[model samples]
Target: MLKRFPFFLMLLVGLAVASCKDDEDKPPVTPAPDTVSFVATISGSQQVPLNASTATGAFTGTYDRTSKTLTYNVTFSGLTPTSGHIHLGGPGRTGGFKVPFNSLTSPITGSQVLDQQTADSLLAGRTYVNLHTTAFSGGEIRGNIQQGTTAPVPPVEFAALLTGGQQVPANGSRAGGALVAAYYPATRLLTYNVTFSGLTPTSGHIHLGGPGRTGGFKVPFNSLTSPITGSQVLDQQTADSLLAGRTYVNLHTAAFPGGEIRGNIRERRLGITLGASINSAQQVQPNASAATGTFTGTYDRTTSLLTYSVTYTGLTPMAGHIHLGGPGRTGGFKVPFNSLTSPITGSQVLDQQTADSLLTDRTYVNLHTTTFPGGEIRGDIKVK
Candidate 1:
């Protein structure tokens, strides 16, 4: 009996050891990471029916890998949102689009295909969010998504100049063969217009793919027409994707269908403009180059315009201009200025077409006068 009891105890011990070993060999079961969320606020000026007004809205979205769904909830306080959607593509990268939500009042959400291709592209930073409006008819606001973070704020808007020069003139507008680009801070909207000094563009349009890709690639947001002052807007999804530094703006013409002007858009930290006026007291002092006196303002959601007052130290404020390119300090050829006159002050209509340019930070503001031949004073339009 004692021997039998010992055998039984040994058998039980061996069974327990085997069970522990089996548990150790089993695969680990880890809980998925918690979902991340963010809120994107869009505040900018837009062209309305009778007059141009400002629009202010916010969007909340979440990306869940466990569910493979991207959900959005947008709200507008100042103006009404006509429509909006989530698009696919990087800043300049071109690709097909899938519409998730069509209206702004309701929650916009959807899931992506859980595949190796989609996952790889996402990791490579090739996705974004976009919202549209009636005034823009295109996309009024845009934002991109990245791993580890949710609802990152976009920096100040800027423009990309086609002119080789890096500085803007204080007097006459740089109306040479240039394309005007604009950016919106909150929505990251980028808008662009290609002007040929009265001569229409034969086959000019904005390229969505990177600079390495072909110039005559597919239309960015839609078919961009030339010979007209009219502009086109890029999708928010596309614009957001651009924030990852994979997108670029490439202008094409019959002479250079592949591309004429090309530059990567980024956030603006400074503004350079030439301001001069041959007036009574300041005839000789037509050039402005003072650091203390600069044009600064706040965006009025009521009007969708940036209200600002210019304080001159060396020169007088005569004509104001805006460009879409890079920081110009010396002498650069930028596009026409989007005037923010009366009803709105220092406000550029951030429509669909111009929104695309603004996202790339390819826009600038300048004060021009007759005194400064090229440009007396230059300051970059930076965002706080």
Candidate 2:
């Protein structure tokens, strides 16, 4: 027994030595990433009181939670920025400056140590970055800071500089106006704001034609008042026409019945497309039906707003909802559609939690019918 005990002791020591050697041979543990990346899309349309400058920019940064340090870089074109800074503000609301860049140059780079309050605001997306140019001293290009490595897709922007020279046969009227708008491709919706001066506008319409041609009226302003603001859901053909730069905004007046001032609509950037395919198979309990549908929409990250259109073929839907769940999973409802007809179109403001789930591809559209009380058709939303 004593001799066996000695041999067992030696075996135990040998095992311990081998285990230690194995530990040494294994790769070193990689430290978990402590930095969170953030990004923003800068444009003139994002300014508090929207500007007419065509400048665009991008802001990228990384926040180190451990060190409380923020490192950032800014790149822009089309404007000679005189200064820039980070400001404490929310979308459409202005606030005081929080941090300043060391230099006012394109491809601006710097680092700052943020206090607890500023850090919290930044992570909550309550901060914005902007650049001031001679033309727009208040800030020519601006964007709200949002968390994520990839910049959120910006809404497609369009603008028109109305002038008498662009009018068909040209006009001698000393008047001018401007149009700034955004188009969401998924919902086929266009929201515009127009401002004019030196004319009492009698009527205004978005005409379908090129720069020097006169065509039929497409969309009309809800009001002839200055600062006209409204939205319109366009058909596929009209949307295509606008994207082709074949549309113009024409404001008619008592003096010039045709058009006092006009400008061709020009696209600043293409829009983001989000869509889903609906079928019975995606339901928690798959149904045996020929019903199928599609959901197409766009999410404006800056406003946390979602606009969508749903169309189905085989099922008579009684209701529809946005369910919080991933593919093949059942979850609670997050949003309800305003209408249940064959084609459902609506917009809703999403809370942070719901928006996060949507951006992560963890939400779906479920259409309920009388035959299937739960859901007749389901589709997982995806960004394209």
Candidate 3:
């Protein structure tokens, strides 16, 4: 019986070992998914006012429930989106859109830690993608949240000026031509207007070459014998090449089959205009009115320069200046106004820092007075 007992004990031990070995040889057990991904097709069905039905789009994204993070990517055709958001709603149902996308670039690939409300909505599948544009303030395209996957989009935005002088190394092309091309980052749409003189080219093309080096053609056009104007939807690689500043417009002439007038492509002349109306409501003392003014400004992004066209009246202006401030709040001095007195009307050049501050659209124009040393009337500069 003792020997039998010993054999029984050994048998039990062997069984236990065999069980553990079986577990080791088995495939790994996968943990439950901690992230959710989805894709949405955008079309007129989700559009507001029944318009912009022509617009089509796609949105793909992933939300990590554990980390409370949301990453998204979007692509759209038929319209440009000025603002985008993930709104709280349901399929076939519409709701308020408040969750904003900040620092947005092309393809809408940005990350935002989901707030409690947004996270809840996402889990419940009550969140959707919304895009707003100039024509459609409500929404141009939208899609309900679903489960899927989407890769991120490459960021590319470009503009280029066509000129004989901007040619590679030296623009020896006595044949003159000018072209302005603007490429939409998200959709890869290329729209251009070209006019040329001094040479009749059989064709024109945007070649894969830079300031000093010349390479093969990337996009070709019909004979530019006449003024060339139209649009072209580019592929991904071609768009990337254009945005890298490795592209140029070279007119093909019978005289020079290789190329004739060539101008390097780059971001075209860029500028922004800002202005705001003055009212007592915008002042520290809302009642201190009758002292109104207007702030007009234009900024050249390339030069980092600003030109101000300011005019004010209805106050004994002690001084006029551009102050860095927000809505209903005041900030420190940014740039001094030329004329310290009232009826200040003139143009002033803003330094780089001052120009940058205005670009934020947060600054205001302050007119000081002896009676009201703080400020008489203020107008917040609004980019136009």
Candidate 4:
């Protein structure tokens, strides 16, 4: 029995050795690539930190090569950040930009793609991230972005600017004071800059009405005077009226209870002659190719209709639509392409908010092709 046991043990050992030899002869198992993570901490001392204040902040980034998307998860303390960026450079080093933020409002998160050069710089541990605010146009808080493991923070892009102006009193008080208004489409915050030389206005309100017409007040100001600035968070209804071109700012005084000065609100326009440079660099999906296009558009706020004519070169058109986004950020679909002929003519019945986006340069026109599964040529539809 002992002799038999020894023989069995030796047989088992031989079998194990044969199995190991087979494994060596066969191809080795390959591991899948991991999702790369990066982090940054910004302070006044960091080279190239905007240093808007003695403030500080942090950033987290993840890169997914399958989708070729880079997403940022960010947080900041002791600072108010309006925008952010991923710039190329080593610690205490100054370099160019790699990726720009899609949005930087509170609860900051943004996603974007980078060109090959920028992507290489980032993966090689040669980049930094930063946050920007009104006070700090360059940047506020910044941190060196390095590859390391940290808890995951998911992010998406915030981003818009809409502007219009009203001259006091279409027919009433020729009183001085012009109201320049800017609407942030992303936050729905409306700001007004008022300047006047003559007139003692008791109060002022943005009312819903037309030139020579009167309606209920929509947004009321805290006070009125020369070189005054105020901001209001807009409601849906008020935004609706404003986009319809039926709203105006009126300065009310004891001298003119109805309104001393009034000016109508209107939308701006960007001519169709927009020469758009189309290339893979601008595509949501990264590639390397070039295309050309143009966008001509006219919008009427009262009717809420946007008419457009688009032209393209270097590809056959498969499909097209209007997208709500800017240069570096990809946004949701808003409208579709209609005209099939040269100088394709299409019209969109937009909502008040959509109208505001068109006027504020928040909307874009895009054309897709079979060759290029993604967009071939796109132009930001702006009010120039």
Model 3 regions more than 4 Å off? 1-269, 341-352
| lDDT tens digits by residue: candidate 3, 148-202 | 5652231222333343434443435655655556554656767555667888787
Which tens-of-lDDT digit does each residue in 122-178 have in candidate 2?
Answer: 989889999998888889988888999888776577877677867887776878777
Put down candidate 4 lDDT per residue, 1-384, tens digits, no spaces. 887998999999999999999989999888746578887766543434222144656777788766767888877777777777788875545677767776666557878877787777878877888676787666655676777765322111111121222233323344555455545354455655556645787887888885447788978877665655566778988876776667877777787776766656654322222234344556666555566767776765446677777776676777878877655556777887766445677787887656655654557777777877567666766454
- The lDDT, on a scale of 0 to 1, for candidate 1 is 0.45
**Worst lDDT window (10 residues) for model 3?**
151-160
Tell me, by TM-score, which candidate is best. 2
lDDT of 3: 0.68
- Model 1, range 308-340, lDDT digits (tens) per residue? 555545455456554454343222333343442
Against the true structure, what is each candidate's TM-score?
Answer: 0.39, 0.45, 0.32, 0.32
Judging by lDDT against the true structure, name the best candidate. Answer: 2
> Which residue pairs collide in model 3, if any?
37-148, 38-148
Candidate 4, backbone clash total? 7
Ordered by lDDT, highest first, the candidates read: 2, 3, 4, 1
User: What shift in Å separates residue 260 of candidate 4 from its native position after superposition?
Assistant: 32
Ranking by TM-score: 2, 1, 3, 4
Say what the RMSD of model 3 is: 17.6
Determine which window of 10 residues in candidate 2 has minimal summed lDDT: 265-274
* Runs with alpha carbons beyond 4 Å of true place in candidate 2: 1-33, 50-56, 89-94, 115-121, 151-154, 161-174, 182-197, 202-264, 268-384
RMSD of each: 12.0, 23.5, 17.6, 21.5
The collision pairs in model 4 are 41-143, 42-142, 103-158, 168-262, 169-261, 169-262, 272-296
